[model samples]
Target chain A: MESDLVTADMVEATEFPHLSMRYQVRAVPRTIVNETGAIEGGLPEHMFVDQVVAAASQS
Target chain B: MALLQGRDRQRVQSELASLANPVKLINFTQELACEYCRDTEQIARELGELSDKLQVEVYNFQIDKEQVARYRIDKIPALVVEGEKDYGVRFYGIPMGYEFMSLLGAIKDAGARATGLAAKTKAALATLVKPVHLQVYVTPT
Candidate 1:
């Protein structure tokens, strides 16, 4: 996803409290989609892609 | 203590030798405020030292408002790994432990000017009609 229209940034939870709280993050490896959809934990590449693709379509 | 030890440093140097183009690592941190800021700075400095194609640019997070906003960096120890262009690869903490491997991989990928994504994934990405902002959060543990 990084090579194309997607831009991925890794955020450190403790270091970025503002961002963490913005997403209401309380667990590790949590991914928020479009700053809304909260995926609680790590997902497989296929699933991750699915979520992103879905979000893109919705947006 | 030095982060990259004797043989470890040598291994990293060899890996960095494969860099196809110049890679710029931009780090943002505020002194006397951010945890692991020193460690992150040290890592980027050492990594840049591994090869001439790599460069490290440090900026104050709180003071460098323009740079911070330009990169959209919202945290301390923020690192942006960019090649000829911004592929939007970002690291928000010290690349220590397992993440060090990820950092190396990112540098190689960025420097190579290509993503190692699967062919199918590339095709799928090619069909993307909207820009996606992906954030992956993780703990150092």
Candidate 2:
């Protein structure tokens, strides 16, 4: 079974209060969608950095 | 305007105090305007106590323009992990909640100058020598 990690309440509780106002809180499956409307999962740290570096280099 | 309420401030302070390593927070709002600027400031301040466990550095984009361009960061409140070499790990939004773990992991990897992937995972990752780009955007929920 897929473990239920990081619940909605947990996310709300950890957010810095003032910043929370800018985001829309929805209870749907909790998907992370990018500006391009693509859903993504939690990426590993190294891979994420590599991506950013690649993007920066392309600019 | 204060981004953190008194209660949250106390909680952050206490958490920082308990950490073994200090972490540095670089704030980008000063250059790139964003709504969460104030909140990022508060986070940087609260993370001060963790200095012993991790070295935390706060940089405002207004002052650190060179670094920002180098990292190709076009957003406010991005975090970069500084290690043996700039690993280029960045968090575009305030790294709280599940993201916090990612942030901490980045810091740990940076500090150790190593990625703690399993042998099999590392072997697989080695094949990706060409390069890969990934961007993930999410709301606080």
Candidate 3:
């Protein structure tokens, strides 16, 4: 919502059962960055941004 | 059929009343073979009804290749929330339950074209050199 380099998508796990399984979504609010790094649960805005930046930098 | 009713409608209307600018909800769906497309479109329409500042546009994913590619929609029942500019905020499935709050929040943010992020966070994001894609998985409940 802020950066041009970032895009955010919210997926309803129940509606898309296949996506839930594919991403191994066993919890609510599991944020997957770049389809690789997974951040489970909600974090404070500051922490969440840090986690997302770190996740995006993952190899 | 009305998706929002009674207190919910009043509450949503109240929230939308404070919108600083106009927002557009671009809904991508197909006529057939899509289970939730109808409900998704209806939800967008209902939300559109809540605020004149918000507009809803429907496109057939199976037929509207140009729009599909323009929005980079890769799935059905998708809703793209855009303000004056495309902020790249998208919902891959129906935004019900907890996600509904997120949808409303997105509308407000997009309406203002501002994320309301703190300066620290904004500065952190400014350091990003590569594209980042975030997919948050949640349930309606």
Among these predicted structures, which one has the highest lDDT? 3
Candidate 2 is graded, for docking, as: incorrect
- Interface Cα RMSD in Å, per prediction: 1.8, 11.6, 0.8
Single out the weakest 10-residue window by summed lDDT for candidate 3 chain A: A50-59
lDDT of candidate 2 over A1-59, digit per residue (tens): 00011111112212333423323323221222221222234456465434433443443
> What are the per-residue Cα lDDT tens digits for candidate 2 across B28-71?
55634565666655665555444465555666677777877876
Whole-model lDDT per candidate: 0.82, 0.48, 0.90
Off by over 4 Å in 1: A1-4, A21-27
Candidate 2's TM-score:
0.57
Two-way lDDT contest, 1 vs 3, winner: 3
Kindly provide the TM-score of model 3 when superposed on the true structure, using C-alpha atoms.
0.96
Clashing pairs in 3: none
What tens-digit string does per-residue lDDT give for candidate 1 at A1-59?
A: 25457788887777777888888878978876666666678777667677777776776
Q: TM-score rank, highest first?
A: 3, 1, 2
TM-score of each: 0.89, 0.57, 0.96
Model 2 regions lying over 4 Å from their true place:
A1-59, B1-25
Report per-candidate DockQ: 0.64, 0.08, 0.88
lDDT of 3 by residue, B49-98 (tens): 99999999999998899999999999989999999888888998888888
**Candidate 1 lDDT, tens digit per residue, B1-141?**
778889999999999999998999899977887779998998888988899999999999888999999988877788998888878778988777667887889999988888777666666677788777778787777
Proportion of true contacts reproduced by candidate 1? 0.73
